[model samples]
Structures are given as C-alpha cells and as structure tokens.
Target: MPTGRALEDARSMLLETGRRILAAEGTGGLTSRSVTDRAGVAKGVLHRHFADFDAYLAALVTDDAARIRSIEPRSAGSTVDAVTDVVEQVFTPTTRALVALVISRDEVRRRVRSPGSYGIPLLMDATAVVMDVLAAGREVGWIRRDADVAALALALIGSAHLLYAGELGAFPDHSATHEVVESILVGSL
Candidate 1:
C-alpha cells in the first residue's frame, strides 16, 4: 500500500486526470477505468481514496470550488469590473464542464446536494461576494439603487449555467453572453 505522501500524490494525480477528461469529453466520457488508464495508476486507486464514483466527483468539484474561491478581485477595479471578472471565471472551460457534468448526472447532483455539500458552501460564498459588490456599487451610484442584487446574482449564475449546458463545450465565442450580462448589470448606467 502507498504511504501517506504517496497516497495523497496518487489521489491528486487521479483527480487531475479526471478533471482533464471531464473538461475534454464531459461526464459522459469519464469513468474509473478512463481516469486510471490516463493517470497510469492502478485501477483501484480511485476507489481506495473515494467511496465511489460519486464521491470522487464530489471531491473533484470541491477542489474546483477551492480554486475558484482563490480568484479574489484586486483593489484596483470597479465593482462592475470585479463582478464581471468573477462571472468570467465561472464560464471558463474546465469550470463549465465540471458544472455541466454535475447537472447532467442525477447521482452526482444528489451527492452535491447532500449535507456538507461543497457546492452549497461555494455557492453561498460566491453569492455573498456578489451581494457585497452590488451593495458597494449601489453606495457609489454605480449600480442603480432599485436593482435587485440577489436576483441579479441568481440571473448571472443561471445564464452561465445555461450557456455551458446549451453549448456542450463548443461555444467558440461568448461575446454575446458577456454583452447580455454586462447590459443587465450596467444597463441603466
């Protein structure tokens, strides 16, 4: 059996391979065999670290959430710019694929909704960040005072999710999506 450091390294390697596969082919192209074969690990390595495929997926999504959380805005930007940066991060290829995979698989969706779900914590944190930015924008008269911040945040999330799902990784240009979201957020400005 692999020792402590080796075990962690192995798990990380498997997860990275899984992430790449997911990004390239969506969930439909991912499996334990595929990950293990691509990762050059024993077939049972993934099972040793996770209870099952769903567990592996949950861990993967949690890893992604941590990465997303690290993309904090610098102090040099307007609230609208900051918000647009965050939205762009969500629409990145890997993130989009991961979210699309989670939504398509019933078992993975259930796992992500369970107690202590990583998705919930990430989402709550993101929503709070958006709300804070919106409030700040309102204080500065950047965002209209009557703008519904919470609804706006939800709309952003929904639009990005739908864009990823509808395109299936083939969206060559999201200028239209960006334009729409930008208009919605700063239309009155």
Candidate 2:
C-alpha cells in the first residue's frame, strides 16, 4: 500500500491530470486509462481513490464549483455588473465542459443534487447571488418592488446553465447569455 502522503500526492496528480484533459478535450477525454496514463500512475490508482469514474467526475466538479463559489462579490459595482461578472466567469469553456458532463450523466446528476453532495450546487449559489442583487436593487428603486425575485433568479440561472452547457449544440454564446441575463434582471442593457 502507498504511504498516506504518497497516496495524497498521487490523488492530487490524478485530479490535475483529469482537469487538464477535461479542459482541453471535454468530458469525452476523461477515462481511467487516459487519466492514469497521463498521471503515470497504475491503472487501479484512480479506482482506489474513487469508487468509479462518476465519483471522480463528481470530485472534479466539486473542486470547480467551490472555486466559483469562493469568488467574493465585488465591493464596488452595480449589482447587475457583479452578477454579470460571475456569470461570465462561470460560463468559460472549462466550466461549460464540466456542466455538460454533469448534466448528461444520471449518476453524476443524482450525486450533485443530493444534500451534502459532492458537486458545488452551482445553481443554488447563482440564485442566491441574483436574489441579493434583487434586494439591493429594490432598496435603491432600481428593481420594481413587486418583482418576483426568486422566480426571475431561477429562470436566469436555469436558462444560462442550459445555454452554457450547450446540451444541443444550438445554444447562444456566453456574451449573448450574459446580455440576456442582464436584460432580464435589470430590464435594459
């Protein structure tokens, strides 16, 4: 058996290798053989650390989501701008690939939606940010008092997720998605 520290290092290397493959080639590029080959580890190493490929994928998504969630809201800016900035960051090619992977896999999706789940619950965080923006906007009379913030926020996130994930290869570009989200939230460019 590998020493504890050695095992940890190997796991880290495997994750980093998986991330590089996912970023460059999307989910299709990730597999036990490919990851172990790239990481120069035994074929069983990934399985030893994670029960299966879906588990590994969930771990990767969790890492990515945590990074997204850790971004502190900008101290100075329109709430719309703050939200837009986050949306732009979250819709990068890397993020899109991860989202697409998660959405397409039933087991992974189940893992993501479970309470205390591994993946980062990105939609929830996005919704929270939108709600915060809506509250601030309401305080400043920027948003109408009667706007259904929760519904609008959910709609924005859901639509953007689908667009960014490119489930059907017909989705709008990130810039267009950003514009649509901003327009929906603030009612103008």
Candidate 3:
C-alpha cells in the first residue's frame, strides 16, 4: 500500500522486481502477480502505471536499452579489455531473459522496437555500444583501419549472447569473456 508519490513512482520498483524475477527464474517465472508480490505492492499498482503486462515489459526493455547505451567502456587497458568489459556488462542473466522475452512475445517486441531500428532491443543497443568502442579503437590505432566495425560489432555481440544465453548455472568467467573477445578481435586488431 504505497501512498501518492510512492504509488506514482512504483513503476521503477515494479520494473526492478520484474528484472529480479527474470534473472532468478527466467521469463517463465515473471508475471504481473510475481512483480507486484515481490515489490510489496498491489497488483492494481502495476496496471495503474502501465497499460498492461506487455506495456510494462516494453518499458523495462526501453529502460534497459538506455542503460546499455550509457555504459562507458573501461579505458584502463587494451581495446580488447574495454570491449570485454562492455560485453560482460551487457550479457547479464537479466538481459538475456529480456532478450528471450522480446523474442517470445510479439506485442512486447513491437512496442519496444524503435522506428527503423533492427535486431533485439537490449542486444541492439549493446551492439551499438560495442561498435562505438571498436570505432574508438580504430581511431587510436588499436583496431584495423579497414575493419568493418558494424559487422565486427554484430559478430561480437551475437557470439557473446550465444555464449551467455546458453548457461544454466554460473556465467562464463572474466577470462572466458576475455578469450571470446580476443578471439574475435585477433585478426581485426
């Protein structure tokens, strides 16, 4: 039973709770009731904020996309290290579940799909960030000047998604993540 402002701001709470459910049990465990129950709010609070469950999911995807775009690549090491850091940030269990959810639900996909944008919501943004990092690498003489950054970005992000999405227990360690990134960039860098 949240009061006025708390009720108004319950959207973030609901979204965070949904993210937790998604990370803990995957998309199959996330529902309006689960979100409300986890947030300690009434179910009506969710509906009051979002038009429906799909709408709520769309908002979650959009919020996550913005978050993905805001991640600054680590500048402490090689471009490989920086890209690896970005990939690790992007491929969390929650994001993987959101990707699965976007793929599974047509309405949620349509709602979150940006006009003229391509690929899955969170992954698309992740690719863009990786591309930015690669582009910066090119400018700094790390990546090859002739490298096709868009294709490289797509390959890196897609391959990392495959590696992370299939994991049922512990996520791949940082060394594994670094290896994947290095393998991909070995020729291009």
Pairs that collide, model 3? none
* Candidate 3 C-alpha lDDT tens digits along 1-189: 846345656878899899889889988899999999899988889998999999999998888888899998765378899999999988878888899999999999999897898788888899999999999999999989999999999999998998897754469899998999999999998
Deviating ranges (above 4 Å) for candidate 3: 1-8
Comparing 2 and 3 on lDDT, the stronger one: 3
The lDDT, on a scale of 0 to 1, for candidate 1 is 0.70
Backbone clashes in model 2, listed as residue pairs: none
What TM-score does candidate 2 get on C-alpha atoms?
0.76
Task: Candidate 1: give the clashing pairs.
Answer: none
Error (Å) of candidate 1 at residue 141 is 3.1
Model 1 lDDT per residue over 44-147, tens place: 78888899988998888778767776666554256656676666665666677777666667786676564764444345445656667677778888778888
TM-score of each: 0.78, 0.76, 0.93
Worst 10 residues of 1 by lDDT: 117-126
Regions of model 2 farther than 4 Å from truth? 1-8, 116-121, 139-141, 166-178, 187-189
Q: 94, model 1: CA deviation in Å?
A: 2.1
By summed lDDT, the worst window of 10 consecutive residues in model 3 runs over 2-11
